[model samples]
Target: MLALEELAAKYIQKTERVLTLLKSVNVSVSPDEKKVYAVVDEAKRYLEDAKYYYEKKKFETSLVSVAYCEGLLDSLRMLGYVEFTW
Candidate 1:
């Protein structure tokens, strides 16, 4: 339980940092701009959900949500849709 809590905290912090970095980034203007923004919006939503779950003491669910958010952000970066460092 302690380890889970610690891990969740770490991931939550990391996700928050990534979200902050994302805000300063501009998505390239291209045909996929709409789709890219949609994915970014979804990632933000997941981060919010993670925080909500964390506050509710649902560590596992919170971790999962944050992981999904991170994955989406990574995908965007990897695909060159947005530029940011993890």
Candidate 2:
């Protein structure tokens, strides 16, 4: 449980950092703007879910949520829908 908590904390921090960085930059999408915005919105929702689970002491679930959020952001970056680094 301690290890899971530690891992979850690390991921949460990473996701938060990434989100902060994202907010500081202007993201221009090559594809449909509405679709890209929707994906970004979904990722933000996952981040919120992660935080909620973390506060509830569900470290494993929090980790999963954060990972999904990170994956979605990475996908957007890799697909050239957003400009940012991890």
Candidate 3:
């Protein structure tokens, strides 16, 4: 059985992977509106929140954070920052 510490570490690693995937998206900067920039900001914030909740042992909240993280990724893809893979 995986220890709590190990499980936490794994969760954190998964969170980090999500962060990296978010960063890999390339967004174009437009003069009038900055869509990608906003999405990235939201994603970073959500990912941080996920980490916070995970550290606090709030699994449900962390899961919600992960949802937000995926939402942001979807938004990024919709905005053309990333190619649609799923």
lDDT tens digits by residue: candidate 1, 1-86: 46767888888888888777775335554466778889989999999998899899899999999999999999878777777776
Instruction: Give the TM-score (vs. native) of candidate 1.
Output: 0.85
Tens digit of per-residue lDDT, candidate 3, span 1-86: 97554555565567567667544556344333466667777877887887788788886777677667768777767766765443
Task: List, residue by residue over 5-81, the lDDT tens digit for candidate 2.
Answer: 88988888888888777842234545567777888899999999998998999999999999999999998888877
Please name the candidate that would achieve the greatest TM-score relative to the true structure: 2
Error of 3 at 28 (Å): 4.7
Model 3 lDDT vs. the true structure? Answer: 0.67
Q: Rank the candidates by lDDT, best first.
A: 2, 1, 3
Model 3, position 54: C-alpha lDDT score: 79
Candidate 1 lDDT score at position 23: 51
Error of 3 at 48 (Å): 0.5
Estimate every model's Cα lDDT from 0 to 1.
0.83, 0.83, 0.67
Candidates arranged by TM-score, highest first: 2, 1, 3
The deviation in Å at residue 28 for candidate 1 is 4.0
